[model samples]
Target: MSLFPEDIASAARAIIADYAGKAWMIATAESCTGGLIAGALTDVPGSSAVVDRGFVTYTNEAKMDLIGVQPEVLAQYGAVSRQTALQMAAGALRRSRAHVSVAVTGIAGPGGGSDEKPVGLVHLAARCRDGRLLHREMRYGDLGRDGIRLATVKTALEMLAELG
Candidate 1:
């Protein structure tokens, strides 16, 4: 069986096939889902033709440094906000050779949740080189850490496919 769930694997396969047909490459910027989105994409054979790289920016500093997320954006909106997700997607596309990019940031945990920003609240964004952008806010309740991360991965993959 594939290491990724069937939905994720199938989504990854579709992305590879579609992007490869168009000679497009994909990049991922991940936080709460870690590199799982990229891992799922790369799991498909011949993904190298469509996937350029993935950045696991689990920290604010990493997000700023690796993907050029503005320090001001992180400070004003925190790492898990839509502003940050958009910047992450744009930055990934700017830094990589990829023609499309997806970004995710969120709190996935049994702890670290506040009334305003609860656990399982995720922000995802996708950008295409032609300036197409998409964003989604997912409130998955308290699905624990693993569940939240997996859900984020699934959503991120779908965003990539949508952008592709």
Candidate 2:
């Protein structure tokens, strides 16, 4: 009955349950997928206990202003790189009270492909208050914009569960 895919739904539920059980809160730093990852987490019935905040940094300025991503970093690595993803995750934790956070930056597009950074190239980073960071880079091929974004959400949720 849910519009979200089964993997996403289950992962969201698991993240909420696990984090809430541990009395831990989560934050999100999102791009490409907009706030879809945060939306998935909030879809759970009692997500409020675990979800502290979500940053929809769709633009470079937002990423810098809201989450403290450095201008030099974006200028050097661009938004969709592992460096930016790590910085975004670290920034989310620094800017919020969450015990853990996940950051996603990607090119979910039908037109943004290039020889190097093609469409569906997503970089995900999860950071814990304990200072542990995990990163995943995925090449989802040309699955179209919606497909790539949804896939990123699913992957981000799974990473949240793992971090939880």
Candidate 3:
């Protein structure tokens, strides 16, 4: 199952309430969760005041083109690595008018497991306008695609809240 809209919106509401008229805007760069992180935030009423834009950079090329993720980073650390996550967050902030940015890159699967990077491994990064950056690495251990994605959305939103 996907994320419940109400649950997602509830979290989003806190962010909306906090940032509205505070001159804060948010942006998202998503990978394994697609655009779900942005979707959840948009579900809340009055989110327009806080949400700037979202980039669904599902492919390495898209990450590089849409958000300015360095191709060398993708080649060296892979898309799901911490370096890429940091770059994604920075890229989102650079490419948008948002004051804070959150980025999600992960492998949520039953097929993408490996000795190094297993399934359900996610790297999340949040960057604030003041240059504070936060990174969290989650290993949900085969929570299935939807479960992992939903958790990612929740965590990404929470990070945005922290940044705000």
The most accurate candidate by TM-score is 1
Per residue, candidate 1 scores C-alpha lDDT tens digits across 1-164 of 66998998999899899999999999999999889999999899999898899999999999999999999998899998999999999999999999999999999989988999999999999999898999999999999899999999999888888877
> What is the alpha-carbon lDDT of model 1 when measured against the actual structure?
0.93
Per-residue CA lDDT of candidate 2, range 93-150, in tens?
Answer: 9999999999999999888778799998999999999977789999999998999999
lDDT of 3 by residue, 6-71 (tens): 667788878888888687999999999999988887777777888999999999999999999999
Of the candidates shown, which would achieve the greatest lDDT relative to the real structure?
1
Candidate 1 root-mean-square deviation in Å: 0.7
Residue 59, model 3: lDDT of: 98
lDDT of 2 at 97: 97
Name the better of 1 and 2 by lDDT: 1
lDDT (0 to 1) per candidate: 0.93, 0.92, 0.90
**Per-prediction TM-score to the true structure, in the order listed:** 0.98, 0.97, 0.95
Clashing pairs in 3: none
RMSD of each predicted structure: 0.7, 0.9, 2.0
Ranking by TM-score: 1, 2, 3
